[model samples]
Target: MNVRGVIAGLLFLPITILLSIAVCLARPFSRLAWPSKVMQLWANSVFWMSGIKLQVVGEEHLTAGKPAIYMANHASMIDIPILVAVLPGHVRFLFKHTLMYVPFLGQAMMLLGMIPINRTNRTKSVESLRKAGERIRSGIDVIIFPEGTRTKTGEMLPFKNGGFLMAIQEGFDIVPVTIHNSREVCGRNSIVTRKGVCRVTIHPRYETTGFTVADRRQIMSDVERIIGSAVQLRGRDNAAPVIELGHH
Candidate 1:
């Protein structure tokens, strides 16, 4: 672990927590139009503190006020902040149910309208996803990690069907996103940070309104291919070696 990275973490961690508390307190009366702004401020702080930088491509692909399912491959914990910081629109994240019980932050998450799923129980997971879809239909865009969990190796994982299913059921478009170099910066299961650049590419939306249950597998497969191709292209363009850094 880099000693400077450690120092940066120590310095930024408390400030992040304090900001989270402030955001939590503001969640009760009205929607935090600036939640993403707060998140961007935090992400920029973390980046500056850790000596990491972000280069985003395809900003023109994102349309304002349009609710679409933003699906991305998970590489590192940093992915969340990066997405929250760069992705436009109000994003309601679909996270594990366990996150909803994490002290003060959890209460704030609930108030902010994050959907939590009990993945252990299939029935409950589906129900939770349905509710999430409803929220999307009601005007909030949802961000989901179709890979379901972070990859330790940085390789793309087999995307779960849940995200696509919700898109099909709710008549929403799927915006495939590829995040590059996060694993190299901060690999899964390690706290150490490496100086590097993380790139996020937002592909144009793939419509799902006409798809049916029989097309579920195909939809997921297509999403996987889109992400894989985007990642590969970014690596080639950046002159980085192509390796599956995601954990199996």
Candidate 2:
């Protein structure tokens, strides 16, 4: 474990939590403007303290004032903060239900109107997505990591159908987002953070207007392929060639 990183994270956690509470209290119930700005600050602070360098690409693909579901690949716990730092405009996450009980952080997240999915219960999951759809219709953008959990091996995981199907059912477009080398910074199930550049690539949005519920599998595959290929390309590009120096 990176003791210094753990210490840094511990020192910053409460500050961000307090900032979150203060911002939420000021905004009151998901007012995107002030809250989004606060989140941006918080994300930036966390990344700075953790020494995580973020390199964002393809942000031009995102259109202003267009509500879309951002489907991203998950590899690290820090992915949320990285997205918060890089993604433009207002955005909320489709997070797991258990995170809703996390003390002050939970209250802040609720105030931000983050949707929680109960994967174990079909009924609740559907209801959650229904609410998410309503939010998207209301012009709030939502981000979902369809991988459902962080990848342990830094390779793409098979995506769950829930998020993609929800986008299709609600007629929301899907933005395929590829987050490269996140695991090198902070891997799944580990809190030790390393200093490195985390690359975020935002692909053009995929419209779901023509897709039916039956197309969920294909939709998932397409998104996975896009993200996986981008990640692989980035890995290859980042791989350093070994050079040997002869004695002079």
Candidate 3:
């Protein structure tokens, strides 16, 4: 690790803790806004510390004052901050249930209405999705990593069905965001940081209002293509060609 990187991480610790506290305290009244704000702050701090800048495109594609299911490919851990900082609307993220057990921050995330999934159990995963659907129906935008986990080799992974299922069930529009250059900045499974510019391209939102279970597979396929095309258009040399969900 670079000396500067270690120093930056140390500086980030207190800010992260303070924001965590704010989220925990603000939970009682309404969780619809505070979590988003806290996430935005966290993103800003990370961007500043890592010397990473962002360029957001297609802002017009997002609808204001309406809930959406924001889906994106997982490239790096920094992708979270990039999305939170650049995406147009407020978002609540779907995270692993294990995260809710992390000291003070875990408690804060639980209090602030973040959806927690028990990836080990199918029954619990379904229950988590149902609860997420309810939250979207009630007008809170949700961010889900359809790939379910980060790409190990910078290639898109097989997308899980949970996000699209919830979108169809709740009649929410799906905003497909393509993040570029994040993998190079932090890469997958590595902590060595570098300074670089990241870009988030927001494609036209696809509405799920009239979709049904029969259309689920097709919907996921189309989104995969959209994100793949966006990545290629942005000149990512190794961008993966969109593939059928179960093929790879």
Candidate 4:
């Protein structure tokens, strides 16, 4: 284990625990306002302790008070904190159901109103997706990593289609977000963080207002293409984006 990473982890553990407890306790009164700020502070502490730098683009695509599904490619664990810090408003995660039972974190997530996607079986998964739809309809934006889990090889994984199914069914818009070089900071199956820059590009929103289930695969494929084009899986570069859009 790297001494620097271990030290960073030790420093952040107590802060994390305290912040989680604070969220669980304060959420009932403040709803999401205070808890959201605490989440940002917790995320900022992680980046500061690990010496992680972030460069973001296309934030203008997100509009205030508009509920949408923010879909992104999952490359590393750092992607979670990055979204929590960078994205505006009260954005909740679409995490796996098992995470909802993880001690303090579980209680905090429950109080903070983060929806859990139960992927145990088809019947249960559909029910969970319906629950997510209710959250979106309530005027809260949800950030979903289309690739259900972090990529083990830094390569983009095939999306699980649950987010898309929810989007089309509920007539919510979809925003494609691309994150590059996140793996260099904290890769899968590792808690160690390396000093590196993570580039994020939030693409224009993809509308799903009148989409049918038949159009799900096409929409999914398009989002996958948009996010995958920005990063190189094999040749990792943690400085700047190699593929730049018109303005970025």
Best by TM-score: 2
lDDT string for model 2 (1-248, tens) is: 55646765676558657777767577755466787877777777666666667666786888878889998999887888888877788888998888789776677677666888999999999998989888788777889999887887788788889988888877888999998888888868565687777778889988889999999888888888988878866554333321111110
lDDT of 1 by residue, 29-68 (tens): 4464656556656666666667766767777889877789
* Residue pairs with backbone atoms closer than 3 Å in model 2 (clashes): none
Name the regions of candidate 4 deviating beyond 4 angstroms: 1-4, 101-104, 233-248
Please give the CA lDDT of all the candidate structures.
Answer: 0.75, 0.78, 0.76, 0.78
Q: Over 4 Å off in model 2, which ranges?
A: 1-4, 235-248
Write the residue-wise lDDT of candidate 4 on 32-83 in tens digits: 6887888888788777667777777676887778889899888776787888
Write down the TM-score of every candidate: 0.85, 0.88, 0.85, 0.87
- Residue 198 miss distance in model 1 (angstroms): 0.8
- Write candidate 3's Cα lDDT for 141-193 as tens digits: 78898888888888898888888887887788898999888888886754446
What is the overall TM-score of model 3 with all chains considered together? 0.85
* Candidate 2 global CA lDDT score: 0.78
Show pairs that collide, candidate 3. Answer: none
Residue 20, candidate 2: how far off, in angstroms? 2.3
Give lDDT: candidate 3, residue 164.
Answer: 88
